[model samples]
Target: MTTLYRSLRVLTPAMSETKPSVRGFHGKTSASTDLLETVGRVFLTGRARAHDYMVHVGIGWAPARVPGFRWSAVTANVTDELVQWLVLDGYGFHQAYFHPDRYVRGQYRERRFPWPAGGPGWYVDRAIDQGIGRALWFVAGTDPAVAADLIDGFAPDRRADLYSGAGLAATYAGGVERHELELLWARAGEHRPLVAQAAAFAATARVRAGLAVPHNELATRVFCGMSVAEASEVSVRTRPSGPVGGDVPAYEVWRQRIADEFRASGRA
Candidate 1:
């Protein structure tokens, strides 16, 4: 390896591992993943209201050669399920920072955190924030600088909580740039509350993937280790009782299974 490559390997441990085909970022992506990515591609490339964009991209999306492809076939297939998901996801986009433990909503029932103020679009913006982050993860891969640009490029009103969600993407993407992390911290400005939430998102995924993370060495604490199986269990147990329902359990199963596949491939 070249000197620059060696230096990079030293800096970001996530860059050291090889991503194989079966466990690649695109590997075994679920219906939710495809739908989310579609939403992200449109948003990252242009400005469109969430409902409008979904209808445009998903509605009347007939294949020319397929005889009679239903308009927005996929969306039509999922029906009310997708609409409900978007609303809930939009809600969580804002709730992410307020909830502390962003992943699990069941923990928030007893707390008295107020819903964010900014009119009805608030949740849509937050959901888009997540989509943008996921898109960056898929398209930019491990390039933190590129990811940072994507997040910073958004207009301020897109969502104040964006940096936090973007930060989650950087972690879940499995690599981070020191300068990029610092830039996000700075961009967060003043109290910088959301950055810690980002750290937790990254750390939780790392632990769930069974990586031997040096949790104490980092500024943010990684959660206790959890196997993919354990996460699926928690997800199932936490469902219905919380806001997440419908296809979520199936998605979680697929996500955990794919994660296990990646981990095994990494070991190989």
Candidate 2:
């Protein structure tokens, strides 16, 4: 083991001699590692409950100064912390900094971790876009056509990580032009890949269990696992509002159908 692991085991109250750690985490964690281990396993199996699951996942999200901390001590600490925090409340875990409850009114809510630079947003891509990406997200409201530019502008090497974050954010904050979707498509440029990724994550929460669940607490948890095609099955596909044909949206019907398909096929 690295010196980092040895020191962490001796110093921190996280290490365990008996309980198992998560797959990527180093050494066993505390004897109370059970819940944390379950959360880690769920996360690893991709039932992850965060927006930026693909990019900011694993020990790297909150890495120790020690090189490649996942192999040992970093794992124990992170597992313990995540398990405890998530048990208390699962929101905002993807963010490196703490997030207050959205409705809470405290000065601390506005405060953020001061490190990692770029003020909690991807300054690198915004720099490349000359802030147009951020502007587009605000104005265009996450229509995949327009938002792909935000993802596409990344340096080829950083594209995966950068685009994944951008994609999830757009999905979470969805607000496309309700009336002009077709026109927007006509105006859109070819940035299909990132658009699909963002749209899928965004669509995850709108439907489940043969029903449409809009803005509901349970609906909010349906991210990071379903794909665009799978999401299409679950969502109504049409805009969510308007004089509707049924209680559920078209997308939700599709989502239910997909769910049935999965059940029948016994794959997921």
Candidate 3:
């Protein structure tokens, strides 16, 4: 059986001991390592069936991460359906991050470690989401034209909903919300190979679309996971935006802001 398909097979209670750790909030560790191990194993194997099941689980657990709330209350609230979606969605994100070709120079690198220079796409947030989105778009067999529309539709509108609420901020931040789309695509599996191909296309599209700012220098620093302010210092022409709202500011603006706040609080 394909590694993914085999992962779809539910494990018995006896198999629990083999799973990975499922750490929770407040540094509390759960004894569910067996469950996580099984899930992780299936996830790493890259099987379509496994991905499909995981997507279902991921969706269910998604609500736990809602804004202005504690996940603790919602963690145990997970239903079997939610678990399925979470697993799938998580896997989709993982694939985008770890896919061999997507890696720097077509090589797999440990995600826990920092990426090498001249690595894959710019903007960790953009790269990760775009990769996940492309994977889902592929699984959905979305025509390039339609996929383009979908991406446009989902693109964050900083003006309209930027500071409304925590949920809105989270969505705009493009973290977990982006992963959910990936989960949906994995479940459908319209055409698997399309995932990788679409990711490449999306990366190119981002540059052309100007979603990536200050293309030359900003792209480099972002890909390396450097802060916007840091990149701006070295490249005078690159005036990047603050981590939060506001127009693109000079690097010193942020530096001074930090200094002033620290001084006022007597923490500088």
Candidate 4:
């Protein structure tokens, strides 16, 4: 533990740098999972605790920090692949938090987001929107009505992903009461399945980390009509066998499968 702490202190900056020989970080067998989890933690902590501006840049540096990392690598860690994408989620949150006028108000999007450059690049925009949706949770101060309005302000095509992100935030972060989550469920309407899918993802994160809390249960019940364990099962059972061929990434297919299961079960 002492060595890990010291290593983290010295290599902290490398968290946001591209392929800088993160020797100490890589020394651990759990480095891949640790790195991805830390990226998400940095963003959530930055927004919820530090209110720091530079963490956004660190998130941008995330993909590069990993040596020879690729989106396809997610297939190898099927259970935790969702967390891998949280790097983009962190980036999206920071963009919205720091430059709300441009990202939130103006609704601008980088047609070609040039980072971690490679195949499956087309999915970057959607992944970022998921983060933007999570940011809306904080931007609206955890108010369900305000969150719905903020998402509604976006282009129609983007609202589903925005709601999905918010669902993840509400489930994982858990600031509001159960009634508030219910209100969010009502507002989500047609996108309820997407919201449920993201909430299930959150359940999996919490359960996997042994960080399951009352709010996780509350949110899962409200959004998914199931307990956290059951909701997590929805995520596990619906996972794509491996990488799929097409414009859509396997991650999306996994999410869609979860969403379809929830929709079919009439959870909302």
Candidate 5:
């Protein structure tokens, strides 16, 4: 699979360049419109109205004719309300699938803690930190320079918390349990672009397939020392079968059966 990632720093004039792309597929505006609307309703109120915000936009896709190849673009804006909404909400284009946890309504924790208390700038800064970390992980494994760039992107006081969360998120989303985060930190000097390349490809696939995209079975299996064929089969079994709401339980049963087969074959 081929994957690519690019980063652009948001500037004033550039914000106007990113009007929403024309809708694709079913002729609706791109999925981002829905996200932006939701975000605008939730946070653009009261004293927060006057705050300037930064927005990060990421696009990932596999061309229709391409099977395993993928590409991604990450763009940002300083004034785009849509971008601000995503950053503030701690959700991105892929939030439906890739967020560390599910979104819950009315779940406000006190901002007494310094970590979440940076006010309007807090979410924007967090988004920047995450964008940089993901970008670095996509391009350079755990290179020190990448880590340094992540640190430099934020205020000195916020570095530890921001990178720590970013690292944990990557480890989980990459399906690396155990010491994956530590390993990443230890290898912070290595020149491993494959990590980023794989992520770019996976991101593209996710964009094309949306929630239909299976989690990274190959990576999960590798971490668990399972065979590629076993992992592939597991993925196929887990995919939804037939139309929506049809045979959903049966699909899950098939997934379990495939898991059993992998175990019996000593491939799990």
Candidate 6:
């Protein structure tokens, strides 16, 4: 509750005034996760009223400039900072949903992502790619092959994060059947571990929030080669305890560890 209160205090007047149901934050899962999405939704709601640059700037500011903490209170209960990458997932989703031609079909890349000053721009691009991958699942009508083909259209270097994003969507948003999931798994090729890692992340989110369903199970089995419980467990077990100092963020390290675990278990 303290976390929730602190997070609430940080919101801008416009965001704080908007009356979202308190009930949405009632579960045992981290409110931080929901806040991450909530802030994005708030910006999305203002997209039409604000210029595109301003909206992007707002989303970028929420995490670092908010009160009550150095980081956004949205990250309070998160065990892994890596999940912070989801911040950009909404941006990718918005662009793809509205302008499929430029973002999806044309495969446009943002050269100047003007947010979170001083952070690595290259990493920002990859984080955005994760969102693009998630959006691909929807843009492709949940067809695994079409999504895979769309991801394939990108440079080979970008495909891993793209596949990882798709894996998250397939597991969490789940519209495809078991066979289709298998096809996606097969399609991921060398990036199968990244796919499994993302599936595990999705399973962790679903299971933690008590939102796990049958399709989650099927995707976990196909992509993570484990039951939903086991996949979530893998995510939890491998999470770093605190800050990690390296060229790569602890989030990527967490992801790599999960992927390595899956590979070691022959699930990847």
Better of 2 and 6 by TM-score: 6
If scored against the real structure, what TM-score would every candidate get? 0.37, 0.29, 0.20, 0.72, 0.26, 0.72
Task: For candidate 6, give the lDDT.
Answer: 0.69
- Residue-level lDDT tens digits of model 5 in 66-149: 222221112222233323332322332222112212211111122321211222433444333343344333222323344345
| Poorest stretch of ten by lDDT in candidate 2 | 96-105
Candidate 2 lDDT? 0.32
The number of residue pairs in model 2 that clash at the backbone is: 14
Better of 1 and 4 by lDDT: 4
Model 2 stretches astray by more than 4 angstroms: 1-61, 64-71, 74-153, 157-164, 179-190, 205-268
- Evaluated against the true structure, the overall lDDT of model 3 is 0.29
What would the TM-score be for candidate 1 when compared with the true structure? 0.37
Model 3 agreement with the true structure over 1-268: per-residue lDDT tens digits: 2432343333212333223222210111232223234434543443343234333333322231243253323333333321222332333344532342342123232243121122222222332343344232332122233333333344343111101111111111222222343442333232222222222222332333334334222222222123333322323222235333343223224323432432343322
Ranking by TM-score: 4, 6, 1, 2, 5, 3
Let me know the TM-score candidate 6 reaches against the reference structure.
0.72
Give model 6 RMSD, 1 decimal.
10.0
* lDDT (0 to 1) per candidate: 0.36, 0.32, 0.29, 0.69, 0.31, 0.69
Ranking by lDDT: 6, 4, 1, 2, 5, 3
Cα lDDT for residue 66, candidate 5? 24
**Candidate 3 RMSD to the real structure:** 20.2
Q: In candidate 4, which residue pairs clash?
A: none
